[model samples]
Target: MIGRLNHVAIAVPDLNSAMAMYRETLGADVAEPFDQPEHGVTVVFITLPNTKIELIHPLGDDSPINNFLAKNPDGGIHHMCYEVGDIIAARDQLIANGARVLGNGEPKIGAHGKPVLFLHPKDFNGTLIELEQV
Candidate 1:
């Protein structure tokens, strides 16, 4: 089952501008930009008291974020991540419940270096859901 809210991911067309808006304008603590070539994104986290905000930008033309940005030029919330005690168990539960997992239905290393899996957006009220193992 899902645990605490891990982070809310936002797709952004411009990483630098988004980072500045959170760091300078909002006076938030922003982490350094991390390039995730495997995920095809360059991401930065805006640390907060309770949870974190993830700013994601396309790393290449083939990046999924690029397609998202193309659909919404201003960008928008891409996904919401929730923590889980056991990723495999959670995945099985979701599958048993008829929830579809994205990709090959396997966990991948996320930005926090934790195992993560993405669920189909339609299965979760049109919002992409990411389950990360705590």
Candidate 2:
């Protein structure tokens, strides 16, 4: 089952501008950009009192963010991540409940260095859901 809200991921065409908007304009605490070549994204985390905001940009032409950005040039919310106590158990439960997992239905190392799995957007009311082990 899902736990606390981990973070909300936003796809951005420009990582620098997005980081500045959050850090300088909104007066938020932004972390340095981290490249995730395996995930094909470069991410910047904006920490908050309760949760974090993830700014994601394409790392290469084949990055999934590229497709997302192509769909919406202005970029938008890409996914919402929720914490889970046991990722494998949660995954099995979701599968048993007729939910589809993205990719090969296995957990991958996320930006936080935690095991994470993505669920199909259609299964979650058109919003992509990410389950990260806490």
Candidate 3:
């Protein structure tokens, strides 16, 4: 029940450096940093021909991205987001299939202002998977 690849999220310790690298060095079309308090992250999207790359940085000490950066100082891929036609249906299907959904198994408003849910990393080959309603 997943559609196209929505975006690949990468956790970075330094948001400014990352943005400069993507915009100046790589010459990519990057969006301005958006502070998502609910998600506890300041994010920017690097646009691509087919998909987008989400650069995420911790918004506070309690942010999940802070923990991720602590584990990997250099920072790396945090999650991969895939689009779904219907988030609720997709969530039910994943649950019925014995897949573990993260964070109370409810959909949250994502960066795109779309419904989004995260599945357990272990269930998806050690990679965090985010399902976003298209």
TM-score for all predictions? 0.97, 0.97, 0.97
Instruction: At residue 85, give the lDDT of candidate 2.
Output: 98
lDDT of 1 by residue, 1-134 (tens): 67899999999988889998999999999999989999999999998999999999999778978878989999999999999999999999999999999999989999999999999999999999999998
TM-score of 2: 0.97
Whole-model lDDT, model 1: 0.94
Per-residue lDDT of candidate 2, residues 1-134 (tens digit)? 67899999999988889988999999999999999999999999899999999999999778988888999999899999999999999999999999999999989999888999999999889999999998
Candidate 3 per-residue lDDT over residues 1-134, each given as its tens digit: 68899999999988899999999999999999999999999999999999999999999778988878989999999999999999999999999999999999889999999999999999999999999998
> What are the lDDT scores of the predictions, listed in order?
0.94, 0.94, 0.94
Among residues 3 or more apart in sequence or in different chains, the pairs in candidate 2 whose N, CA or C atoms overlap within 3 Å are none
Question: How far off is residue 113 in model 1, in Å?
Answer: 0.9
